[model samples]
Target: MKKYKLILFSTLSLLITPVYANDNAEQLFNERCAACHSINDNSHITLRERLQEKAPTLYYAGNKFNRAWLQTWLAAPSKIRPGGYSFFNNVNVTDEGDVIDESKITTHIAVNSTLAALLTDYLMAQTPKSDLIALEKVTLGKINRSLGSKDFNKFKGCGSCHQDEEGYGGVSGPQLYESIQRLQPEFIASYTRNPEAWDPKTLMPNRHLNDNSIKKLLNYLNVISQ
Candidate 1:
């Protein structure tokens, strides 16, 4: 009878452990991350609210980010967007062009390894767009680096906004050299295909890229990230 009781207790403990961890992670996220980032779905948020946001929404983090990268990034945060989350806030109108005031940008809050792991686990479970992510079918095809670079920089004009190499492109958009490491391939494809579908108030234009173009771009992103 004592043996059976112990077995039942062990089974219950195993089940309850995950719940407690989840609760703790949620509490930690609320305390440390909620001020800058949002875990709630903000698709219906007003344009003014979206423009005023301090950081990117994490409600679809599970669908968007690579788990390992997210974990590492949380522990040692870096600037993904050189111009800051709200680009308008960091840009200065100059005689040459609109220049990003790098001094105005702030780095993300870094957490210790334990806190990062807990936060990453919690954030990775918040996948509201699992269906959308599922719809994207990505195939890894080999693309020549030179041709890909030409297409990315000259033909497609992506270099005008995104950096395929560190400190080598415009600061208005998030750096793309580490995109494959940071973001899921499907999320990249989906966002590139239609930026407004993901963020209604996004500054990214709808280029209406075909599936072939997206695949080529994905291949290019993969090569550059590596």
Candidate 2:
């Protein structure tokens, strides 16, 4: 009889453990991440609003980021945006135009291992309902480097905000030349399909390119990353 009672107690404890952990994660995210990021959509916003914002929205972060990457980034935060979130306040345009003064880039907040894991768990659960990314089903396409370069620079005007080469492109966005190293190919495809899906208040405009174009862009990213 005592053995049965012990078994029941152990089972109950096991069941309760994950619930408690999930609760802790939610509470921690609310306290830490919510302060800087909005878990809601704010993507279709103006430049003034973007300039005033403190952090990027996490409304679709689960769809946007891989769990492993998020965990690693949380523990050892690195620079993503060249000019920082509030670019108007942090970056200054020179005689040469918007050059990134490294000193003005805002540092990311770092978390300890435990907090990082908890935060990552909570963030990974924030999946947006979208069919844009069929991760396992989608295959990468080949890039014509020359044409891709033209699209990235002139046709799409992505160069106005993002960087492609060492000394080129704009300073308002994270450097794209290293995107293949930093992000999953599927993530790149999904983000290109709809930037608003992951970041509602993103300054990036959705160009509505076909899947082939997105795949080519991703291929170009891979080539550049190497």
Candidate 3:
């Protein structure tokens, strides 16, 4: 399977012309990603825009994603959101609550390693404007597994819907442990501050958490993921 994927990736490389080989990542982002993504902070986005959004904003993607994961994901697109950005759009009403219409779902646009690398670098630089999440202070608030586990499950009650371990926790939300590898510290910190600021329709609640609490949570996520 690995060999097959490699072959496919290599085949994809042949599609791009050498004329645009020296293409700027920022230019590539504007031309390729802008249609489906917002590269701005989106502080002024309206409720209608929120409901109509097709993909997540890239304004703070750098703060939210691991560089390695970004590179891999860009090169090989996969479905991260089981329910998708908007389940109502992609799902059909059946006897079941709602079943995703796999055929109507759009896949991510893939690029070769060169473009992916440059794009990843560009994407990583798109950090949030907020200076509230002080890296130095955040680093100091690191928590241990015992404390983190309790906070994750009991205090936050996050385990009610999110996967805790291999077979534990609820399946409604993404696995927090896996998220540790995929997300960046600053993004989590910013999102926790106000989930609606990024995505108005996001399921994540505005926990009204303080900077210190978020920093500790970030530390806990980092520790457990490692």
Candidate 4:
């Protein structure tokens, strides 16, 4: 399986032409990723649903992804859904009631390091206009008693249908004790804006929060960074 994976990655690298060979990551991003993501848009939609029927934007890539992780994810594209990505927007379903189409789900084979590095660098360069909030700079002391409770019950409403820091919320979406460390912020933001953007058939709802909620959530995730 390891050899098979290597062969697959090699085949993909070969497919990336010499014209694109040694192509600057930014240039490659412009040519390949710009169509689906915005560099600075901060609109925050719902968990499963996207503002538009597209995937999320990338305004905060710099703040979100681990360069190493980014490289690994992009070298190969995987099916993130059981029946592919879709939303329950039209269904008026609750997050608790929502269901993922597992039949359409699949994972991508890992990629070679060089291609991954190029993609990671390209993605990491994207930054939002906001000043460095350094939300990640917050100390472990801050996440103690009161603040931790606030994270569970306050404006975040994370407890409503998902688990995180306190593990007190509903079990709807993925856990987030280290979500910031796990997901690309840009990817998360973009998905927040438009769940259906990349996969038109996802089961998540489209959140329609104003800009403030978006920033707050972003900050919340940064604070929760592992």
**Top lDDT prediction, candidate number:** 1
Task: Give the winner by TM-score: 2 or 3.
Answer: 2
The digit string of per-residue lDDT tens for model 4 on 1-226 reads: 9999999999888755535456576666665666766665545545434535344456666656666656656776543222222233222345665444444344544546676677677667765623433222332222354555474557556555555554344444555555566665655565555555533544456776555555556566666664
> Over 4 Å off in model 1, which ranges?
1-22
| Model 3: per-residue Cα lDDT over 94-146, one tens digit each | 78445557776677789989888989888888766445344424452457789
lDDT of each: 0.87, 0.75, 0.72, 0.54
Q: Can you tell me which runs of candidate 3 are displaced by over 4 Å?
A: 1-18, 21-23, 91-104, 128-130, 140-155, 159-175, 196-203, 210-216, 223-226
After the best TM-score superposition of candidate 2, give how far the Cα of residue 54 lies from its true spot, in angstroms: 0.4
Candidate 2, residues 64-166: lDDT per residue as tens digits? 6767878989999986777777776777778979766677666787987877888888887776644555652446455778888898889878889888886
- What value does the lDDT take at residue 102 in candidate 4? 47
RMSD of 4: 9.1
Candidates 2 and 3 compared: the better one by lDDT is: 2
Pairs that collide, model 2: 42-200, 42-201, 43-200, 43-201
Model 3 alpha-carbon miss at residue 107, Å: 3.1
> lDDT tens digits, residues 8-70, model 1?
999977754443354688877776678989898788988899888988999889999999999
Which of the numbered candidates is closest to the native, going by highest TM-score? 1
